[model samples]
Target: MAEKQVQSRYAPDLMAGQVALVTGSGSGMGRATALEMASCGARLALFARRKEPLQETAEMIRAMGGEAFVVPGDTRDEKSVEAAMLKIKAHYGRLDVLVNNAGGQYIAAARDITNKGFEAVIRNNLIGSWQMTRAAADHFMFENGGSIVFVTAISTRTALTGFAHTVAARAGVTGLMKTLAAEWGEYGIRLNCVAPGTIKTEALGRYPIPPEKWHELNRSVLGRMGVAEDVAGTIVFLASRLGSFITGEDVYVDGGETLHMGHDARDMIHPDMFQGRQRGDGKNE
Candidate 1:
């Protein structure tokens, strides 16, 4: 007789009837994470500037027999964020999970970064996430506990000259996570982060790296780039019962990119002819 292989039935269904707020949840990693949480039965609260995409996410959750509420708001605006939080609280009464995943950056070298671009990135990515966390923390404190997951980038620690503003902002988020973890532990709140590596989502188009450089970006401890699921799953875990003991830590889902430290700076000086690699599989971008 053939025997079935035994596997651990470890399902962290910690979010049933729990309210989860996801920002920039219309597409890419944010959307994926929201959908995953819904699959596990958490009622979702989605925030994004675009209505159509946020609605799309809500539709997916509804299709799965899960509940979701949509709130369109600009992450960079404090009033907008507060209003969004108020709307969620009004709809659900309590929030169990908060994922600050909305972020952006101008992909230029430090020398070419403009003041406007720097300020914009800092305001939207760092300050916006801070406001969202603080607003939710006030409610969680009274409730005695909650979870927050910040979507940072592996590039923050393994510095790249092209993303100066994003790096600084995300580094600040790391520090914020640690501070809050200590401050809010008595409330049973766990604060953490997830840093993703080269992912092939819609945002990947924004990075104007040539084929050789793009390929080099994947030459990490692991040889291939990760998809949205790789990073999304980590966020779900961090916010679930499985990660109850984990906090004040940032998990990197970069397929070993940080372990590799990226390619040498001297590689940038190589002639195009010498590099002999083209973007778009030899098609000019």
Candidate 2:
């Protein structure tokens, strides 16, 4: 296979006639992916819990001379999601792409997370994917096939601590993608996921940045901290003709961060950065 190229064409004519429904298309990676797809010739149906952001994304698409539709609602709500699907079918009469990217996360220790919190993450991450996949599958099968991309996270595989609930839920989504790919192959439906690492976006501020973690984050990967466009490009590929045969797989867009396993440089740092202090010692004290 050829190495993937990272590129974005504003208001692309490539996706000119294809239709796509992207959940959580209001902001972050979802917003970027929606724009890129629209540029490439895809008509977009943008979804989110809030109307304002969805409208903004749609407007951007329109500005790029691409067609767009704003669908505002909770994707986890099957009724709402199916209604959105119905609207798309009414407007375009065909569904070519589905991107399940709506998800939530909060910082908390595993035991500290409440049942509600855990279930909330699962509902949005896992169940929401199922709902959209089911709706899209029905329409897609009728058309003989389409592509579905799920926005997953690398933390699930690497064992991130504070987001235990999310880790579990997202891992399940990866599993779901694999199974669907197997069963839906004959129908021509392709299912895959983009596992994003740390990408700077609106969500960055919400996650609580501690100082200039940029250096750490930049060095966090062999390349650098990810930008929204990095993941967006991968999404564009998965939804385009470029990814025709690819299915039932997940790509880590984290720039080799996962490869830092036993060789984690943080551990190799001179045991002298804290000369006289023991591990976790409060130097300020």
Question: What is the Cα-based lDDT of residue 44 in candidate 2?
Answer: 90
Top TM-score prediction, candidate number: 2
Encode model 2's per-residue lDDT on 1-285: one tens digit a residue.
122232465445666679888989988999889888977888898889999988888878777677898878787998998888888888888888999988988899988999999999889889988988898887655466888999999876788889888899899999999999999898888999999987878887776766367547643456668888889889888878888989988999988878775574346864655564545544532
lDDT of 2 at 99: 90
Per-residue accuracy of model 1 over 24-63 as CA lDDT, tens digit each:
9998999888888887778999999899989888887777
The total number of steric clashes, by the backbone 3 Å criterion, in model 2 comes to: 7
Q: Which portions of model 2 show Cα errors greater than 4 Å?
A: 1-11, 214-219, 264-285
TM-score of each predicted structure versus truth:
0.85, 0.87
lDDT: worst 10-residue window of model 2 = 1-10
Query: How many residue pairs clash in model 1?
Result: 0
